[model samples]
Target: MNSSIFTPVSPTINTSLKPHQNPLILIDNKRVACARARKHVTRTKALFSTTKEIVLKEFHQRRALKIISGLQNLDKYDVASVVIAADKGGATHVDIACDPELVKLATSLTSLPVCVSSVDPAAFPAAVEAGAVMVEIGNYDSFYDMGLTFSPEQILSLTKETKTMLPTVTLSVTVPHTLSLPDQVKLAQQLEQEGVDIIQTEGGKFSNPSKAGVLGLIEKASPTLAAAYSISRAVNIYVMCSSGLSSVTAPMAITAGASGVGVGSAVNKLNDVVAMIAQVKSIAESLNLSTIEEVVFEESNLRL
Candidate 1:
């Protein structure tokens, strides 16, 4: 609920983005991010894998993984299947609908933290009561499919209202990737002032790459990546780069300034559980190590 929550757990490192130390603490214990991490070696090919046994214990060091089942998805069986895959695949957490029943079901299936997504500020309290560790107010992709879009003011107002209702709960607000880059940065700063704990950026829904293969994939991830790079420098809170992200873009998000990434559709859309787990492992591995040393923090607070 407060900035102090992340201070003790996340370690500090210098980034080329600036000479000064940047805040690395992203999620705290409230998000059920208390997973213990240890490095182990595989004898098969002399490979080293840093297993994400528990991520909450060290989410800041490694990019946190959140596999979402979708905000509008109400089917418990479908949601449970995704939850099972997320856990078996070594994901740090799972995101599901705000329904208390779904929350309960997800909790029953996995030890990971459950994050409930809903635009209705009122829906959060009950989900929080039902065992959701974190509450997200935006997963704009689902709403956009229905021709609904939120204004900057509306998102800020929702945050204020949600914060009032659940003052002590860990809250993450999404900056609608639909907004212009300048507008998104402005909105991110405002959310921080409102005491929003984490800011999630989304752009996959807006991007439709023209080319095929890697070029297309990068184009698809461009929206969120651009927003992540610009917004992370302006705010001192946790930035989650999500949407249109794949194993290819996951590492790019972390290097861009996001303390972590939230991957939906990419993992959940797959029909096979093994495929879903493989995708999760691929994305998690991308965040395990990065060559980008410095992330320049540029403060550009444009007005909303």
Candidate 2:
């Protein structure tokens, strides 16, 4: 990590994402700060060690999918339905409320990494104990209706506070869309400095798509894609582009520079697990389009 966490790392040509890619990250005088990030992330692999390799492989491929069951959703059946769909549909992970019992429930339902989302730092430790593979600090959309907002300073302070409480667990903090793009960039840098493993960007609720059909879909995803494009370029870690994303714009998220994407309503808003899984598979297929296109390209070149 560089002294300035928000600065770009040595940009490597990402022509492909390999299943067994090496995890070694080299640090020069430029990124001495990220040295600790490399060390701690490795040490903390126990949480998702079972699926870490695949999760990261998909991330590097820019296809890792995280199914969200809603931060405000508490009905066990509803959460469980999404968890089942996520596992069956090939998501890299699942996110639910910060409730410990739900964490346990979600974990039992699927072997995929179980990420718990919350704004409350106090809710994390117990959830971690209950088998949460990763802990997240923002899903601010849930609070938007209540007329609440999380300022950049408040989010950063909460991140620092969460770090103090659980130093070794994988921590993912969301950069509130409520902040200006420049402020979002600054906060993401500070979060990188804080050793956060993943930075999530959200903009679904805030974006009001006035257009209809595909145009509307793109309109909805524009904010987060803008964030992903800017932040992924600036930071040296995974950026989970989320909010208002659909199959059409999902591939755009990765192309825009996100390592993975957090999807909520696309799956959660569905009425049943079957529909949820179908949505999940649709997304998985979309994200897999790059690999498919590459294979076809190689085959065509051979034929030529």
Candidate 3:
């Protein structure tokens, strides 16, 4: 057996009167704080895989675009098309169903970080082992269509189980739009306390648009937008505005304070892979344009 690699440090304290006279020289608080900051950065880098760190950086820049393959979608060809679109279209990552085979297939298709989504905590470990860089607790729209709903307590329970299983893997949990806005904020806060890396908001299934064209698009996105606006304020973690969003509302999501946006039906519903790529590229370009406009507006305000 090899010897242990632990190195022990001396514990002696020098209590001379001269040491007390120049305490700042003996212990520079600024240096200590900076060291701690560097350690934190190192720890975060270690916690997430390199691809995940890149995704998080995009999130921090408020420009992350995640193309989601439905959680219930099992068709390999469909998943492949979606993954290819995300990669060619400039999305930061792709979210797919929590199946190890799908995880493997998605990884084979794109260099983007693959995020697996499921309400079942037990399903995440196998997917993570299969090469998924991140795990999500929901894309609860499918469950809603089945007339099932997730309560805040149940969501918290699921989050706890997932963290226990994969403590270091990046986690994103969706806040169901079925709950009241205040309740959504409360759940987001609790998820943050549980160390969830991201919070996603959804509301398309519940929205009933009253108009067509751009007005309809805005109407469809209102629920998720509201949830993003409310939950982003309530939690310090990044919020991803998802469900019912289009290129028209994608920029609005950023303005609503989301760190990023997740597009699913908007891309995945397309029968042609080329159309899917076009849609993804459109949303990505919209986000970029929005970011530039935000910068210009801020500069103009400063000048004023």
Candidates in order, TM-scores: namely 0.76, 0.78, 0.80
For candidate 3, the clash count comes to 0
For 41-103, candidate 2 gives per-residue lDDT tens digits of 776665456444544666776667999998889999999999999998878889999999999
List, residue by residue over 228-296, the lDDT tens digit for candidate 3.
Answer: 999999899999999999999999999999999999999999999999999998998898844565688
- lDDT over C-alpha atoms for residue 3 of model 3: 44
- For model 3, the local distance difference test gives 0.90
Point out where model 2 deviates above 4 Å: 1-57, 289-304
lDDT accuracy of residue 256 in candidate 1:
93
Give the range of the ten consecutive residues with the poorest summed lDDT in model 1: 44-53
Q: What are the candidates' C-alpha RMSDs?
A: 19.4, 16.3, 10.5
TM-score of 1: 0.76
Per-candidate Cα lDDT values, in order, are: 0.80, 0.85, 0.90
Q: TM-score for model 2?
A: 0.78
Per-structure clash totals for the candidates: 8, 3, 0
Comparing 1 and 3 on lDDT, the stronger one: 3
Model 2, position 106, has a per-residue lDDT of: 92
Flag regions of model 1 displaced more than 4 Å: 1-59, 289-304
Descending-lDDT candidate ranking? 3, 2, 1
